[model samples]
Target: MDPTPPVPHDLSPPRDVPLRLRPPRHRVDPRARRWWLLRALASAGAVTVVIGVVWWLWEPARPWLTAPLVLAALWTAARAVVEPRVRYAVHRWEATDLAVYGLTGWLVREWRVAPLSRVQTVDAVRGPLEQALGLATLRVTTASSSGAISIRGLDADLAAELAERLTAVTEQTPGDAT
Candidate 1:
């Protein structure tokens, strides 16, 4: 007889499980669209200013650069208009007793789930822009290398509360969170 003890059914990994990820139920705050728009505009404006300066200083290259500058401006304008709305619609997150789920991205979507038992840390982050907009991102770090999940564009207060709740739940859950 083999010396190894039989693995418990509760702990055994599922075999040939089909992958089906449903979208998370909670949508990010609506203000996130405005924040994204402002950010996109600021970035595009900065690039345009730099290009304009170069075109003004370098007379000979102006003819060659004009096309690129125009193209860039058009692209930026289109993206600034469309991307924010798309991202706002697509980004959703939900936290439960068992797991945290997130769905993010516009063109390329990603869905993430982090079980409470494996969660190692919970943090709420606010950048200058996020602070200005009164928004925050809740980050859940798990034991796996690719297990970090960021639920962005949450109301600042809500994000903080969520982080605290997740921390408390993970602490009580039975696991090394390693």
Candidate 2:
């Protein structure tokens, strides 16, 4: 067997860090969670209203039908209000590292990380609803067929900036297509 030892990870500032040991890319702006909550609330409200209207028209078992609708509305509203308040932590990308990570949850936190080098493309998609909300979705495509990982409900400017930055990094990497 060869007698070689692995190098320790150098923990230093951006200026002093080596090219390979730089911090990883990560960022989180959960400020737009309110929009998600609003959307969810709107959906629940629409469903409840539809059921109410149907009950008025059809005159079905009032208590049986309305009870579940009421419970669902309350539960959905509670989740909407509560989920957004959960903290989402994001980390910025580092020079040597390609991945950016984000973690979010109240009781059960979840983490998502993407490698900048693996990114095939970055796009800014603005839909009618997002346009009204002044938000955009940043999608990063990877080599896998599962489709891109998209983060939505981000401030337009911030999303654009992040997308541009990621694109630049991806293009600059060696062997990356022009």
Candidate 3:
């Protein structure tokens, strides 16, 4: 057998020396439930429309409609409960490249990497729904829309902070003056 020391698996103070930070990355906020709420509200609206049509027309196919509407309601309600919104607290530092990245989402994961030279604008937007929830969405625009990334469902303050940070990073990068 070769004489080699085994690497430590547990790295607590009493155990082994910790190699990395306790938490590698930090979460921006609790998962947002606004999207599912919107979806559920839309689904409910559809069901209302269908019910109104059935009542107004008295169609023979009303029985079949019941099943489909019931199914849709169940699905929408379930999605509202199961899918939670996710946000990320970005920690972007310089490496060899003039680039930064933003990560967001929970059920649907998204990563956006854009070179500082390519970033055109950073904006924080809040819609009616977002306003109701006191949340905002930060959009990072670049020369290429296909490479764009949006960080959604953040508290207004955090979204503004992120937008400022991104803008600052872009402005400070060399060779970006125009």
Candidate 4:
């Protein structure tokens, strides 16, 4: 008198199933490129200045410092020119009822997904540079340390609205958010 239905013999997934996560649908605010550029240039300038000062002050170390100074200059040029564009092209984010998705990084990109059921908190952050550029970052925290996601370079208003929406959704969803 068994009532259970028989299991299907074919358990393999369909051949068309995607093997990797697709990129998030929305690109970050275009101004993010300028923000990143300014930040990179400022950092490079500071490091170059500091190294130049040390090289000047320490006469005995001048010969050894030459290599470092040259390397710093090269790095500065590359970062100021290349990193911002690459980062802008690579970074993207999207928020859906089921989950939040983010793609980040320039050198070693990472794709992240955080289900709404697991969301613990949503916060919008704007640093000095971001404020000046009218950009914000949305942080979605989850119970797992590695599950948290940050969607950077969003429009400030959009970020705030998204945060509020996410908060409301997470509240209504039936879960402990852990």
Candidate 5:
């Protein structure tokens, strides 16, 4: 026998059990597309502008030096334009009797949960950009260092309703934390 005792978890398979760890699936409103597009454009435009200015000031490098930066900025912008849609497709949320779960992130997937009893607060915020786009962000705070769960690009009304529902549930349900 090996010197060290085999840990229980070490004996388990590497593959994740989707039903247990996987969050419930739900897509965001289509308006998220427009918001993402505007965000991408603004970000890309700023980068491009900065590159153009730098190229102008650093005359020796001329067009060659800034060419790569311009191309990269455009590519990043393009990706940004499509990011929201991809994120929306993968976004999932479920409020069970035990807890509220929110799954977000595009390239780096993150699954977060906040037990109803442990929920310290729930809020819906809409900034100027979100207002213009008819969107709002839902934030749920728990007593964890992992921090709050922020779901952005939700329809304004839906966010508001979810916030209210979360508040009600948090009040009625008991937290399962030790």
Candidate 6:
């Protein structure tokens, strides 16, 4: 009997293997909840300012506009309080030896799979809000513009780890050199 083993043509999971391409089940840093609340409050504040302006400038229209504006303010507050948790629940990402897989989105579900060979750069980006929350967003760029994807809301350290690992794997992949 021949003892040679079969070579893997690609790093992709077997067709029969159910796509376990979900992000790890770990919860995000607790501070993300506060960050989300802050953003929501900021939005509601803006709406409040607008309502105030309308009330001062158009006294006669106040009755008609006030209710909607107040409702809007309430909705904004509700969104701020509820959306972060909903987002956290829906967000998941996993770094496999062969590829990076993630499911992200609240209303529009997006599934991402970027093979190591196709990864061009892995960036760990943090804005003021993210930095304050000790979080980072990982962006994976590929040769094709449409192939790029970002995994947001990861802990800063975890994002770094994923970026470093992806970069290492990408550098070693064949046919990736210019």
Candidate 4, pairs of clashing residues: none
Taking all chains together, the TM-score of candidate 6 against the true structure is: 0.75
lDDT of 3: 0.55
Instruction: By TM-score, rank the candidates, best first.
Output: 4, 1, 5, 6, 2, 3
- Write candidate 4's Cα lDDT for 1-178 as tens digits: 2232322222233556433466776778888888888888899967987898999999999999999998898888888889888988889887766677799998899898777788999999999999999999999999877967998888898888889988887888788977
lDDT of each: 0.79, 0.58, 0.55, 0.81, 0.71, 0.71
Best by lDDT: 4
The TM-score measured for candidate 3 stands at 0.62
Pairs of residues clashing in candidate 2 = 24-93, 24-94, 25-92, 25-93, 25-94, 26-91, 26-92, 26-93, 27-91, 98-116
Predicted structure 5: lDDT: 0.71
Q: Is candidate 4 or candidate 5 better by TM-score?
A: 4
Pick out the ten consecutive residues of candidate 2 with the lowest summed lDDT. 2-11
lDDT string for model 5 (1-178, tens) is 1132221211122344332455654556667767776776677767777777878799987768677777867777666766767776777766555566688877898988766677888899998778999999889888888988888778898888878877876777665532
In model 5, how large is the Cα lDDT of residue 34?
75
Local accuracy of candidate 2 as per-residue lDDT tens digits, 1-178: 2232332222223555433433334333444565667766778767877777776777656767788678777867766876555532332222123544444344674445555566789888887667777878777787646556676656677677767877777787554422
Residue 61 lDDT, candidate 2, scale 0-100: 65
Q: Tens digit of lDDT per residue, candidate 6, span 1-178?
A: 2232332223434556554455543445556666677777777767877887887799899889988888877788676867777777777666655676767766688877776677778999998888988988888887765666787877888788778877777887786722
> Candidate 4: minimum summed lDDT over ten consecutive residues — where?
1-10
For candidate 1, lDDT tens digit of each residue in 1-178?
Answer: 1132321212212345332355666788777887788787788867877887899899999999998888778867866898888998799887776778899988899898877888988999998889999999999999988868998888898888888878877888898988
Q: Which clashing pairs does model 6 show? A: 23-92, 23-93
Estimated TM-score per prediction?
A: 0.84, 0.68, 0.62, 0.84, 0.76, 0.75
Each prediction's number of clashing residue pairs: 0, 10, 0, 0, 1, 2
Model 5 segments more than 4 A misplaced: 1-20, 56-58, 175-178
- Candidate 1 similarity to native, TM-score: 0.84
What ranges in model 4 sit over 4 Å off?
A: 1-20
